[model samples]
Target: MLRAGDTLVIWRLDRLGRSLKDLIAWVGWLKERKIGLRSLHEAMDTTTPAGKLTFHVFGALAEFERARIRDRTQDGLAAVRARSRKGGRRPVLNVDKHALAVKLYNEREMPIVKICRTMELSKPTLYSYVRAANGVTDGPPAT
Candidate 1:
């Protein structure tokens, strides 16, 4: 819990806020609570008007940098997609394994736990396979 005179010290001003708006809101909140914010790297102390102004300027620049990085990432992804290439982790189970899991789940003869253990899949993964096969059930098909 934070008290009225508590101080928040951070390595850098940029680390304190996700965005400019968030930084402003946080500073306002701390001010209202009579708390001080100090950033070692920036040598900023929010207890003073000059420090608060400096922090806001730094926060805005940080957010601008983040926006640029996001834009660049999106552009790179778009370029990759244009080449008919896909990104992200491949599915753990291939088509045959997925089909077998779905079949076992639809059969409803084996307990869900046993099926998961036999297939080396988690409950959620097994259920997802069943779902992809359109085997909609209110709950697990078997014991």
Candidate 2:
């Protein structure tokens, strides 16, 4: 909606966006089109150098805050990695359980239903594990 000589008026700086960065970006876009901004509450007019400088300062502060948040998030993730095996939900099948299931399916000729009952797993879950162990990646055989 911006055009040369046009001005975007707002009740307050916050009316522009939720974040200072967004407001700054909007102001930059307006400036690119030779448009200006006016905030009633702030009584600031981006048609002048002083108003533009004020916006620039807000934008710089927003960028600094964003960097700090990113750094803190990285530190938090590192801390979590230091304490746990992995961050997600526990696996449905672990190494020992997979081994036992494979042994029953291959060596003992145990029925899938029996394996499911013994392992406290559903039939589909047992079949999936057995199929994976048997290298049957394509669905059950046509036979």
Backbone clash count for every predicted candidate, in the order shown: 0, 0
Evaluated at residue 91, the lDDT of candidate 1 is 89
Cα-based lDDT at residue 112, candidate 2: 73
> Candidate 2's residue-wise lDDT over 87-129, tens digit each?
5456577889878977887776877778878877787777778
TM-score of structure candidate 1: 0.58
Show the lowest summed lDDT stretch of 10 residues, model 2.
Answer: 134-143
Give the Å shift of residue 134 in candidate 1. 24
* Candidate 1 residue lDDT tens string, 1-143: 77799998989766766678777878888888899999898888999889989898888888998889889988988898999997566786889988988898889999999989998989998887787689464421121
Residue runs of model 2 more than 4 Å from their true location after superposition: 8-28, 38-44, 85-143
Candidate 1 residue pairs that clash: none
Residue ranges of candidate 1 with Cα displaced over 4 Å: 88-143
Q: Candidate 1 overall Cα lDDT vs. reference?
A: 0.83
Question: Which candidate should be chosen as best, given lDDT against the real structure?
Answer: 1
Against the unseen true structure, what C-alpha lDDT does each candidate score? 0.83, 0.73
